[model samples]
Target chain A: MKPIFLLRLLVIAGFIGFVEALCRIGIIDNFTMPPPSRIAADLARALASGKFNGPIRATLLNAALAFCLAVTVGITAAVVIHRLAALRTSLDPFFATYYAVPVLAFYPLLIILFGLGSAPKVIIAFMLGVVAVIVNTLNGLDRVPRVLLKSARMARMGWFATATQITLPSAAPFVLTGVKFAVAYALIGIIGSEFIMSTDGIGFEIAFAYNNFDNATMYPLIVLVMIISIIVNMLLSIWEKQLLERRGLR
Target chain B: MSLTRIEILGPILVSVALLAIWQCAYWLIGDIALRSPGQTVRFAGELLSRPTFWPHLVETAKAFVAALAIASLLGLTIGLLLGLGKTAGDVFEPMLIALYSIPKVTLYPILLLSFGLGLSAKIAFGALHGFIPVALFTMNAARNVRPIFLKTGRVMKLSRWDVVRKIVFPAALPEIFTGLRVGFSLTMIGTVLGEMFASQRGLGYLLMNAIGLHHVDVIMAVTLMLVLFAAVISFALLAIDRHLHKRF
Candidate 1:
């Protein structure tokens, strides 16, 4: 890493260490705000006891399944809609409205429909992720140069060939952007669903901890979630950068 | 007029048809779990007429507004400060991004413990949700400010305050508005989630109550109202964004 980059990392580490020290010295109470050392110890214990594994696996599975379902449905819908300009315009308002609406607000209804299980959580994540993908994919495809399509048509390229060779590739970056957003949304959606109603998940675990006032356990779980989010986000950013560089869009 | 109308009409028609199918399916099912649109509407109307409805709505609205105000002020200040200094931006950006990516709903238990299951928890939740977007967006907007403007101002001996007030603030308004719109939605989400987890009153509380009773129709009605409320707020924000974009 560059010197500045290393320096920046050190600064962050120092800041966190300072905060942890403050908590240790009782400048910040452990009851309300546990120190970093305590949280790390809790995390180690939770991991060793295998208590964290089940919830993490379940939550990740729900997020992945929902993400797949949303991307499949969203991209297909976008493709069909992009073929008809007039259809896209009329449906724009609905998409905007749906985007604004907190899909979580529909959780109660979903619970009624799918019951309090992984299925409802998956459905909620799918709802949150799908529209963003559809909207982004549509915009991306619509921006393909008209001349490119016309030229492909003149070259006797069939619709399928044109879409596969020309449209989809060009739209990949935008779709990835949508996917990145969807991943975050999926995590939130699944967690929110689990919090509201779930038998097992990290969300449920947190709720359980809260209900019992297990502050030590609760703090570590929150930190774990934050770490996971950061890692995932970092991976996505690297992926996006590589893809963009390949496309010469970086 | 011809092709365009159909193009626009096609999706609307399809959507309406889909809704009709859903309505029919619900009617056929005839279960409390599958509430027909008509039933949901009627149920919603009844719920709206209840005295408890107004208080819940008012409480949610107040929490939302308070959170938004606090988030806007704090986010703007922090965002501007970070944006102004390259070192600050580099150091804080990853931290902000990490916090933003974390499912903020996870913090509810801690917030509840600290604030004790009251409006303060809801407000803190809303602030946490709203702050990240505003700060990030403002930071980005500030960084993107043309160096030429600052350079010229410095050459003309413009003070730091004047440079920010005249050059930076105006230039950043549109971007800030973009952040505000996002922040608004997040604030709403946070308030609802916070309320759902702990509050005794609010739309989220009522919706949960309805769910527990298997009052599916009431749940649907409240959800519809929530959607409408979100739509109205977003539209209003969009108008503001447009005006600011034009002015800037």
Candidate 2:
């Protein structure tokens, strides 16, 4: 077995073991502190029942769509802001505090514009991810060495050509980090929105189970959401590494 | 002076343009559900005079402050524990990181289920949101303390407590402050969201109540207040961070 994987497994197992001990020792009640083994079993049962199928698809679709939109809008805005000092200075304050705002509080207004459908959720997810992306991408572009740009200028390259060929390539690492950050935010946005106000999604399923007091189902569903999101994050990070590595080869 | 004026005017001009567009959109849409910026701001002014306003605002403030306090206490303890202990950090860091990665609000239902629809539930949920970031950040801060700093303490023949209090703590302050900033924001999100989900009182409850009654004016007023509250708190935190940065 890979040593890192083994270590991770051991760590997780140790946690579960501790929880099991606490429950066994009557330090923690089953209702509040369900045994990890029981939760795992419930997960298996829940999966077998295929209860999460629709919600999983719904969340993934919504989050993916919103993330794509965020990426497009964010990168475009970043490039524009990078080129225009006026625009960048004007919008910097708003972007800095974007994360502080209780963005989902505006859901009621969103509902009015888009109706009580997936549209509001999409917008919420987009806003959450896009702000992070814009900030990071702008910072990344700003960090590009002036010497490189000056060299490009000496070559008599057009602004667009210089930016595309020189600036964008060097700034890829930061942009990718922003994208990864956006994905995480997008998922959080979708899940939180779903939990707060949604007709469908893993978040809805969680609220459903909670309302029913089906603790077993609820615990496992939360675990499932974590597991899926973690896997997605790992995949994204791997992709980022590969992209950067390929750039190095070039 | 001219350049400074230009810099200041840039954001103001942008905001003005955006507001104008919003007004234009209001005219075009002509939806009762949507209000003009003037209408919303006027309503917000009126809301300040309402009897229900102070109680709801106070409740939210209480929960927000209480949650941050609890989160800090718990987060610091756990962070220090895991950070100082090599074996513990190895064993528990992964779990803490995994927990942080998950949208913490998902666990809100559990908190609500246990604590019921009340202030405690809101505080607990808020603390949950804030706790992980603070803990993880603090853990990193402590774990990554420079060996040279520790060696300096040893060279001075300092006691263990003295070494940690004088050397380790100052080094970790910046990251700890970062964690607190993130924690504070999460706490705000958690508190507001918890009240929105299920609560008898607070700004979120008031906003949700407005939504239920289709009181668009009240909703707009409450939401604007919430956003402003977030902005003011964030600016305060930023100032504190800057001061600390200067000191360190």
Candidate 3:
């Protein structure tokens, strides 16, 4: 494992060095891309300059809102669907194909209905993320030991209590997995929508910068979004592994 | 109904239910922001008949085909290489996963910068979206090939190429097909998205143009067509995927 990690680090460093060399040699012209070191430097200055504070805050807030909405609503819907065999069966096809359909195509209609504001982005993010949560939560629910539910019923526990105490705890790991996907989806939906059509946000800023050939601003902002997403994903992954290990399910 | 019957009937029922809900939403929202299912279908038919729409359709199709080809070929080659090399696979799998989760839309500008604003950029973007999943799935599938089979091949004094061709290829084909299925949709999405963001021709461009012009008819028609295309192809591929998995 240690050697694998070292090798991975070396590979990454080597790739970066290669790119840096290419940039330095003028093979990869400045117009196409700056070097990794330059991107990092620009990213720091972009953060320290605080010019992007507003867009960053807006994107983060909208993503959080969408993530929360997706989790809550998705879990609830999955629970209800789990109880109804017919509905669950019928909805299976939709869930399977949901991600394949470009939900971003509906952004125009959403903008029209909700107006050209953050509301549409949030809705798009919610739409993009909710089905993932539903599918994963449903999967987790399916694996909840029947014995646990039987014991709850035998103990005269109510549906809500059984759900909160028995089902949810048992399914927590899988739900966390769903939450991880939701984070990625929410970011993608929000940022993708903003890229397509929006007045403000990190995605908009990237697009805005790109249009003006502002490679400095554009590359830094792109790097920042990737760094933020990767960090969030890593944290969630660690938490998920811990949850699984604690449950003796890993 | 049995599970098989429900599986067949379910999607039809769901489609009807979806159309009903769409109709309801149309009535509620009125004509300002949406077109009804009937209107969308009619407009879609009109779009299909229009000669001007063909060029855009052809352009998108060409880009999508090229992207899928590149993604599948390159992804399979990389996946095979990594899957055959234990150390290499271990070193790169996590990196691929991290790349997968990143908002790739953020990287489109970089592609545009390198490839410029044309088919090449669009194909590159589409391939970028598609390549990871195929590689990941293929890597896992190849890595998990039965050890006994490889040992049998070694005992037969087969060369590496023969061992891979006669043993691993057949074993990994199903999962590789699954990867391709997913890659197909993602490539379509990336191509369309590339066109939407920056292009002169394609369904995506038309949708973006309609959005700018506030042409609800075109937006609904194009969106409806794209969704139907994606959903139909996905379902078909899913059926084949399930069949392959069951057989293997």
| TM-score winner | 3
Worst 10 residues of 2 chain A by lDDT: A1-10
- The TM-scores of all predictions, comma-separated, are 0.92, 0.90, 0.98
Candidate with best lDDT = 3
> Of the candidates shown, which would achieve the greatest DockQ relative to the real structure?
3
> In model 3, what lDDT does residue B222 have?
92
Evaluate all candidate structures by whole-model CA lDDT and list the values in order: 0.85, 0.84, 0.92
Fnat across every predicted model, in order: 0.62, 0.53, 0.74
TM-score of 2: 0.90
Where does candidate 2 stray beyond 4 Å?
Answer: A1-5, A21-34, A146-157, A241-250, B1-3, B143-146
lDDT of 2 by residue, A193-223 (tens): 8887779999988888887878888999998
On a 0 to 1 DockQ scale, where is model 2?
0.57
Against the native complex, each candidate's DockQ, computed on alpha carbons, is 0.57, 0.57, 0.77
Enumerate residue pairs that collide in model 2. Answer: none
The CAPRI quality class of candidate 2 comes to medium
The reply for model 3, stretches above 4 Å from the true place, is B1-5
* lDDT, residue B60, candidate 2: 91
Q: Write the per-residue lDDT of candidate 3 for residues B1-248, one digit (tens) a residue.
A: 13687777887898898899999999998998899999999999999999999999999999999999999999898888889899889999999899999999999999999998998999999999899889998999889999999899999999999987889889999999999988888888899988889789999899889877889999999989999999999999998998899898
